[model samples]
Target chain A: MSLQLLFDALSLGGIYAIAALGIALIFGVMQLVNFAHGQFIACAVFALILPSSQAVAELGLGRLPTPLLIPVILGFGAALALLAEAAVFRPLRNAAPVALMVASFALGVALQNLLLVIYGSRPKAVSLWAGLGHPVQIGGAQVPLLQLLVIGAVALILAGLALMLKHSRIGLEMRAAAQDFGMARLLGVRANRVISGAFALSGALAAVVALVMVAQTGVADVRMGGQIMLIAFIATVLGGMGSLAGAVAAGFAIGAASALLQMALPAEARPFRDAFLYGLVILVLLFRPQGLFAPAGAKPRV
Target chain B: MLSQHTIRRRMAASTPLVLALGLLAFVLLATTMGDRATARMATETLIRVTLVAGFWIFVGNSGVVSFGHAAFACVGAYVSAWLTLKPAMKGTLLPGLPDLIAAADWPALPAVLTGGALAALLALVSGAAILRLSGIAASIATFAFLAMVNTIWANWTPVTGGTSSVVGLDRYVTPWVALGWAVAALIAASLYGLSASGLALRATREDEVAASASGIDRYRHRLLAYVLSAFFCGVGGALMGHFIGVINPDAYYLNLTFLMLAMLVVGGIGSLSGAVAGVLALSLAVEGLVRMEKGVTLGATTFALPAGSQEIIIAAAMILVLIFRPAGLLAGREITLPARWVTGRGTTHNGPATDRRET
Candidate 1:
């Protein structure tokens, strides 16, 4: 029982923690909060659903192997990011911080209403689990194949992100910009391109999480973005608000703890899981105010 | 030069009060007649207007948009309701009080004041922790506070009745009652606007370093104004709760918060008059143009309105206002009157065109 629950927690935490890294990158690059970041998840969910629609079977992709769907999903995620940056964030550049923040909220509301109108406010799935099969029953435990896939994807994404941030030119530019915008500009780095790149990466990450979430639950709803965004926000804040490493760690801790609490508590107490997560964030923020692991000399700015 | 400027300022400032009282009289007489429909219309907006005005007291002063006013209002509503509905204090709901003070049941006016006081207390307590953070951090922390309160309210079933709507209050919100409170809030907000505290607040908001250097205590003043703002907000919440007769915890959540925020932003961030204007405009929009989506004969084109059109209109308005009138209609920088139009108390010369050079 313990092993099965632990595995479930790990898979869920890994996906959330991976997605949160994208959010952390944007915050690190630009001091903007980008409240509309969650909509990427919504867009991803919709994109993935197209392949699984009953119409997809009619169109002949239903019989296609799972390997073909993987590349399509990755492409869909990246596209979602690029589209959002062009449609929303780019226009908000010259405005005051407060105005930009309001724009993020307006963008969020617009996306949500649009999704409801287009998708009809019903839950959907990327595809029917016709060939995915049920949970694999191991000697004394049960591990779902989808859950294992999610874990592997999260691991690969995290490793890829870690390497890219450590070695890539864009990553170095992002770090420089975060350190000092004026200095980065003086150093002849193209700050605007870097910021857009960060937003694109964040959106892609959220899309990946969306795809994982749909596959694991086998259901997607318009409201799913708000839920995931709320958690990602809490995770980011608890992990010191701007550090990618902090966001991932916080996401993993929050996700695992919430899952553990859900299992530990009785049926009547399950709904309190999110409330518990929020409460934990509040407590940490009030007490520490700077997060658990921020270095001693870290400034308040990104 | 300074003395003449002072005299002119004193004379100019009193004009708004006289005009406000006149507007109040007209408004009162305009809505006095009619049945339940008229009564609801007249009284319905008073609380909302009052709440927005209360919000301006802090927001206008600090220049930090707070997302937690709803939580304070929630606290006020719950506290006042619990008090007014107590078995001892409520004559209808609670027929008698404790053995020591069974007849201590208060009336509508005092009960409203009591609600405001409790809200102020809640503000003081919360502000101690909240006001320390500045800008976005402060705003987000308040959101967390709202979430926290919602959690507690949703779970504390025995006290809040938990998720279920609280009902059964005497509907004593006549036009006079609401107008009386609304007038009081407007006066208080306007009064605070011209006060030294207001000066300190504006100074801090407009220029923090300069204000601090000028020997103003920024943090303490901000907190005081916030608490004061919360007091009036509490009154508005109680009035809203009592008038509506049935308010659930969800009613005071983010939706209402957003509406209040929209009201402030649309009116003009730091303008008390603008806040009032915003409430009036929004109320009218929600009631009028928003409903006119079916058909408004615009020349010859009978444009079929799309579904969920109100969101689109409001969102457009918000975007437009942000782009064109970022400081709102009467931002902190109002046109300085030349005093030629001042006749005793009526300085009724509509503010001249915007100062293009100010920015």
Candidate 2:
């Protein structure tokens, strides 16, 4: 039971970590919380199927061989993010953070509505690698193959991101921009290049989340991304707004807390798990409003 | 000779009066010329005015964006539902409601006031903890608060009917009733904006360090505004329940939260006039698009936008507005006596003399 619970926690945590990374990437550089990110994830999930008002998704990209499917879906996500940047965000780059936030929200609404127009309001079923749902016995425990895969994927992605941020030139620029945008610009970091780079990486991470979530649930829902997106957003804040590593760690912590709370709470009280989780969030903010792993200069000097 | 102070004060009072009159005129026009549907729409718009004005009280003055006001609205709606529903219906639909509440069936006015009072009490309790934080952190905390309230409301099935719509609310809201509450809300907001704490709060918003140095208690003032704002929002929620004749937890969820915020932002979060104007303009545009979606007869043919295109178009419009006019259409100014008209020609008054101080 313990080992199964451990797998459950890690799988949920992995999904949230990737989603948080996507949000943190954009926030680090631009100081804009992209509220439309949930929509981006939803769009990626929808991309797997042909556009139709029918209840069942016709496997469009999902029918492709794995090798071609991965790259195409990731590209779709990246292109969507880039299109949004050019069409909406880029024009309002110089506006106040609040204005940018509101615009992103508007963009999210537009995307959701567009999806509704194309696919209708009902949730669609998309079967991909259903064979992976089989439980595998390991070390006196039963864990699903997909859960193991999700954990591995999360680890691989985190390591790759760490190396990229450490060694790549664009990664260095992204870090600088996230740390201090005005100073980075003054110091000659290319603004448009870094911003676009961050958006691309964020979009790719969103796609990764979409694929995992679809695999786990065996369903594609326009509304599916919102719940995870909200949890990931909280993780980003709890980990510190611009801190990628912090976001990942906080994501894991939140997932673990949720799993344990579900296990420990009485059946009658289990429905209130989110209420308890969010209450903890408020308490954490009261104690350390800058977040647990906040970077330097997060607090006001005055 | 009247001093500048007295003139500014009178203009400050004039702003709300002007806004109330404008709203009243719209209500009257809708009632006289339009059908019942238009009257209902007008009522919805007025209820929104009350909400947005309530929203502006805190956000405009404190520069803090709150996502939890809808939770207060939720509280108000449910409270009003508990009060106004037939006691027999309550017994069946809300078995978990305390015996006293289940047994009592009250009229609408007192029910609405009690709903607002409950929400104000909640704001006071929550704000005591939440207002201690500042900036984006406070905003996030409010979001969490909203999530918490929603979760509880969804699960507390016996009392709230859980995720299902709680029906049987009396449809007591007319265009005139909405106008009356909206005017009351506007007057409250306007009076608060010109109050000493309101000025101090705005000062803190502009420059927190400077305001603190000048002896303003930012947290205290913020809490006061929050409580006052929650009261009107709660009333607005009760009014919405009466208007729609149904109350649902989902109605006051993130969708409503964002809708209210979008209205506030598009109107210009900086001033009262911006709030009022934003609601009127956007509500009109939305009503028009909704009609077009139902199909419009233009000259020879009936044309309709794609079924879901109204939301997409509205969202795109909001984004465009932000891109072009980030401070919103009003840019933090108010409708006031024109300098040319008030001071007469050749004086060439520099600006709206009392506008900046009022905002």
lDDT of each: 0.70, 0.87
Superposed on all Cα atoms, the candidates' RMSDs to the truth, in angstroms, are 5.4, 3.1
lDDT of 2 by residue, B64-139 (tens): 8888999999999999989989999998899999989998889999999999999999999888878887676677
Q: How high is the TM-score of chain B in model 2?
A: 0.92
Candidate 2 - chain A - TM: 0.97
Clashing pairs in 1: B88-B96, B88-B97
Instruction: State the DockQ of every prediction.
Output: 0.29, 0.66
TM-scores of all predicted structures: 0.81, 0.95
Error of 2 at B304 (Å): 2.2
What is the per-residue lDDT of model 2 for residues A36-63, given as tens digits with 9 covering 90 to 100? Answer: 9999999999999988767777899899
Q: Residue B324 error for model 1, in Å?
A: 3.1
